[model samples]
Target: MDLEKRPREGSETWVDPRERPAGPAVRREPDAPEGCLAVAIRIPVRIVVLVLVVPVRMLWDALVVAGRFLNDTLLRPLGRALLWLGRAVFVWPFVGLWRYVVVPLGKALGWLGHVLLVVPLVWLYRYVLTPVGHAIAWAARGVGAGAGWIARGVGAALGWVYAWLLTPVGHAVMWVLKGIGAGLAALGIGVWTAVAWLARYLVVVPALWLYTWVLAPLGRAVAWCCKGLVWLLSTIVTGIGTALYWIARILFVLPALALWRWILTPAGRVLAVVGREVWDALGHAWRVAGHISLALGRLLGTLLRWIFVEPVRWVYRSVLTPVGHVVRDAVLRPAAEAARSVRRTTRQALAAARESVRQARADFRRMLFGEPRQPQPVDRREPSGREPRTLGSSTTALTKD
Candidate 1:
């Protein structure tokens, strides 16, 4: 839908902005016409580039396929295995130690510190120190009030003396000093006026007359002489410049221009056309070579699949698979069952004997100690990864609650 309103159908002056094309309205300049030389150059250059690029494109494609095969078959698996080994060797042990040992120890130390130091400090701050600080603050407030009162009394006395005794004496001194200052300022002003008048007549008047009368006419004459000299020098330089310009044109510039206009320009245009043709041919050849290489690679992959992969796959499916299944059912299953039976029997017998020994020890302990006391359980810490964990599962006691 067009959000902008359309131009009125009757209005010849109005054009709808939405009706205009998305791009700029300006037309593209047409390509210049190619001469016979460029046309002639393009075909041969493309043929040569195509011939040269085909083999290289095929080689590059082969290297790419080989590198991919090697990475998938060998390098990728080796890198994954190394990464797993590094994690197992370097990372997992530290994680286990931190989880199993350090975490527990840290929790125990934190609890001990809280009980031993933090509790006492908190008690002292809440009881003894808080009361002492409050008492001291209260005493300091009282002392401050007394000091403020004393300060106010002293300030009042000082203000009274300043108002009554010092004010009149300062006023008398200021009046006398004002008279003396006025007399001194008048004397200085008269001396300054006399000096200014004498200096004006002695130095300033003479300098003004010299500049206005004698020096002014002399400077005008000098300036006129300088102007004439500059004009003469400029005319001589201009003549030399004109002569040099002609000499340079005859000796170098005209010949250079002639060489450029008659020889180099035409040659450069020809070379430019040839270079453009070569560059275009290279790009075209490269694209064509890419298509050829892709086709060749597909053909080669199809041939390899028929010759190697299909035969091996067929052999594995038709020949080995049935035989392996038969062996697993007939031979391996019975062997595994027998092993499991033996293991179960051994474990059961061992467990029964251990139970007997434990019962005899318990009987002896009861007989000797008259029923041993059971120990109490401590607070359970957070469970580690020894237990199986499921996704989205939490082991925290609060979560269970």
Candidate 2:
């Protein structure tokens, strides 16, 4: 091949072939493996297996054996011993404290509180507070009854006055006022009717007559004269407009219409027909393109289903899903059960702690305040009204007792 004479001129940079010395051609060599790969290949398989695989297998076996031995011999016993110790040292003591010591103490305190505090409070309320309250109530009732009797007498006098004297006077005054109001209303009505009649005759009638007889005719004559002038001007304007319309129709409109009807319409029809044909061709092409696009889409969908979707689905269903199941069974389920057990145990411990705190608080209160006082009901029923007595007399009688 004439390499120098070839399309070298098309490029921007040029070189003089005569001035440049040609170098030796670089002969391509066949690719060979690297030195490391050659060494790996040359090494004995038995030696490689002995150096790399045997130790790993031995380590794996040792780990398995050691784990089994530790679990069976050491871990299980240790776990059992820890569990037994925890129960004996912590759990049993807590249970016994709550059951025996805390519960009995609470019961005794409750009973003692009821007997010492509640019984005395009940007795004092019944004897001392109840009598004092009754005396106060009786004194208040006597004062209220006296005031009520006086009020009733005054109200009766006022009611009698209103019913007999004030009511009749108010009715008579109202009757007189109603009669006066009726008379004044009738007088106003008669005066208003008279004024309306006088206004109709004196003002409204004369105004109607003047408008009917003189002003209406004068207005009609003036309107007619103005209408005649307006009609004449409008007629002249209409004639001018009609003449211009006809002139435009003859000069421009008719010719334009003729041009459009004969030349443009036919040409437009031909162009429209050509356009319809071209549009149909383009539409057909677009339809074919759409079909091609649809086919390509279907093909792409099929390819995606085969290449990506089906393989992914298969991996999920066969590999990942089974692995998930195995993980759940081997790791997650046991971990979940352990968590639940721990949570239940923690809740029980917390509940017991809370109960112990409540008991301790009650014991502290009993120690400090000498147990809780119970409320006693006071007898609130009134005694017979026939046996009314003063506070001083009753107190003296009690002192003597």
Worst-scoring 10-residue span by lDDT in model 1 = 1-10
**So what's the TM-score on candidate 2?**
0.31
TM-score to true structure, per model? 0.68, 0.31
lDDT of 2 by residue, 195-276 (tens): 9999999999999999999999999999999999999999999999999999999999999999999999988976665555
Which candidate's lDDT is highest? 1
| Residue-by-residue lDDT tens digits, candidate 1, 1-401 | 22113344343333344446787664434455668998777777888888898898888888998999999999999999999999999999999999999999999999999999999999999999999999999999999999999999999999999999999999999999999999999999999999999999999999999999999999999999999999999999999999999999999999999999999999999999999988877776776788889998899889999999999999999999999999999999999999999999999999999999999999998899897668986645445648765443555655553
Instruction: Give every collision pair in model 1.
Output: none
Off by over 4 Å in 2: 1-262, 282-286, 374-401
Instruction: In angstroms, give how far residue 108 of model 2 lies from its true place.
Output: 52
**Backbone N/Cα/C clashes per model:** 0, 0
Give all candidates' CA lDDT scores: 0.87, 0.77
TM accuracy, model 1: 0.68
